[model samples]
Target: MEIETTGIPGCYVLQARLLRDRRGSFIKTFHTPRFEELGLRTDWREEYFSASAKGVVRGMHFQLPPVDHAKMVFCLTGEVLDVVVDLRRGSPAFGTALGFTLSAENGRGLYLPTGCAHGFVSKAEDSGMYYKVTSVHAPEQDAGIAWDSIAFDWPVSDPELSDRDRRHPRFADFETPFVFDAAKAAQ
Candidate 1:
């Protein structure tokens, strides 16, 4: 696998090398040694999956403090417009976002560090997404920035969002709790 850095610190676009034969194709999505070599966390505390239809938007979410996690997200079956926003206070790109097209066809995934908020908008009829997290979920700590509050060009016209997501506060309304620490992240 090859990892490419995004404009935001600690956010990466990962590309796996695929092996193809007459039957179909195969790809090693994750390997511990390789991730360790890149200084990424692999001891996942939780794993989750979501299935959504086109125009469905699932997040702009994150966990605070003790439950904050580093995440690895990939498209398992179809396609999506994955988005990550830097919520690290005082960083150059704080409140700014980076967007990418993630799909089974492109074979690409994204790595978002603890201080980033993650979400995706489905692009195909039945897009499937899988994610691994370094920390487990904490419902009490669950929080988010409203998807429409930030400056983003969502590919969909009327995205279907959960009531919880729709009620999230605008970016400017909340004070971010996490701050980017390059040294800590590098460790």
Candidate 2:
């Protein structure tokens, strides 16, 4: 796998090696040694998969400090326009947003460190997104910036969103609890 950095500190785009043949294709999403070598988190505490129809938007989500986590996500079935926003105060990329097209066809995934918010817009029917996170879900700590508050240009203007997502605070109005650490930024 090859890991490329994103605009956000500690965020990465993981390009997994895909081996294809007449039978099918194989993708290795995680390899401990390689991750350890790159200082990426390998201790995943939870895994999840979400299936969404086209025009669905889910995102700008993150957990507050004390329960925040690092996440690795990939598209398993269809395609999505994945976006991440830096929420760590004092970081060079704070408040900046980055977009990546993740799909089964491209074998690309994203690695977002604790102080980032994540979200996506489904680009095809039955899009499946898989995630590995370093912490268990903490509902009380679950928080997010409003989907329409960031700098991303989502494809659909009236995309469907969950009530919880729709009620999130706007980015500019929310006070971030995360503080950027230069040491962790190297990871």
Candidate 3:
């Protein structure tokens, strides 16, 4: 696996090696030791997959403290416009956004730090997205910025969204608690 940092300090774009042959292809999406060597949080507590139809938007979401999370995501069976935003206060990239394509064909994945918000718009019908999360789901701690509040130009205008996602706080109203500590990050 290959990892590269994104504009957001702790966010990363990882590409897994895909070995192709006459039969098909093989790729190992996650290897604990490599993640450990990279200093990434690999203590995943739960894993889940979601299948979304085109034009569906799932987030700009993260959990609040005491249950904050780090995630590694992959577009497994199709394509999506994956986006992440830095919400950590005092970070150089705070409020900045990064958008990119994650497709099964490319074998690309994203690593989101505890304070970053993540969401995706399916570009292909029946897109399958898989996640390895460091924290368990906590309904009471679920939090996020509104999908439309940031300057990101999502490809879809009439996006399908859940009620919870639709009701999240807008960027201007969000009170973010995470901070970037270089010392801690280096460890």
Candidate 4:
């Protein structure tokens, strides 16, 4: 796999190398050594999958401090427009967001640090996403920034979203709890 850093600090887009033949294809999606070299968390406490239909928008969400998690995400089937925003207060890209097309066809994945908010908009008839998290889910710490609050140009005009996501507070209305520390990051 090849890992490439995104504009946002601590965020990465990982592409897997596909070995193809007449029989089919094989790809190594994850390997601990490569991840360690990149300083990405490999100690995941939980794993989950979500399936959504085209035009469905899922988040702009993250958990606060004690439960904040590092996540590795990829498209298991179909395609999606994955989006993330850096919420770490002291970071240069705080409040800034980035979007990428993650698809089964492309065999790409994303690694997101604890201080970022994550979400995705399905681009295929049905899309399945798999993710590994460094920490378990904590309901009390669950939080989010309204998806529409950020300056993003979503391809879907009328995206299907859950009531909870629709009710999330706007980005400007939330209190950011994490701060980026370059010193700590280097460790």
Best by TM-score: 2
Pairs that clash in candidate 2: none
Q: Please, what are the lDDT tens digits per residue for candidate 2 over residues 45-113? A: 999999999999999899887989999999999999999999999999999999899998999999999
Runs in model 4 with CA error above 4 Å?
none
> Which ranges in model 1 have alpha carbons more than 4 Å from their true place?
none
For candidate 3, write residues 103-159 as lDDT tens digits.
Answer: 888999998888889999999988999998889999999898888888798898889
Quick one: ranking by lDDT, best first? 2, 3, 4, 1
Worst 10 residues of 2 by lDDT: 178-187
TM-score of each: 0.95, 0.98, 0.95, 0.94
Give Cα-based local distance difference scores for all models.
0.87, 0.93, 0.89, 0.88
For model 4, what is the error of residue 114's alpha carbon versus the real structure, in angstroms, after optimal superposition?
0.9
Error of 3 at 66 (Å): 0.9
Tell me each candidate's RMSD, in Å, in order: 1.3, 0.9, 1.4, 1.5
Worst-scoring 10-residue span by lDDT in model 4? 178-187
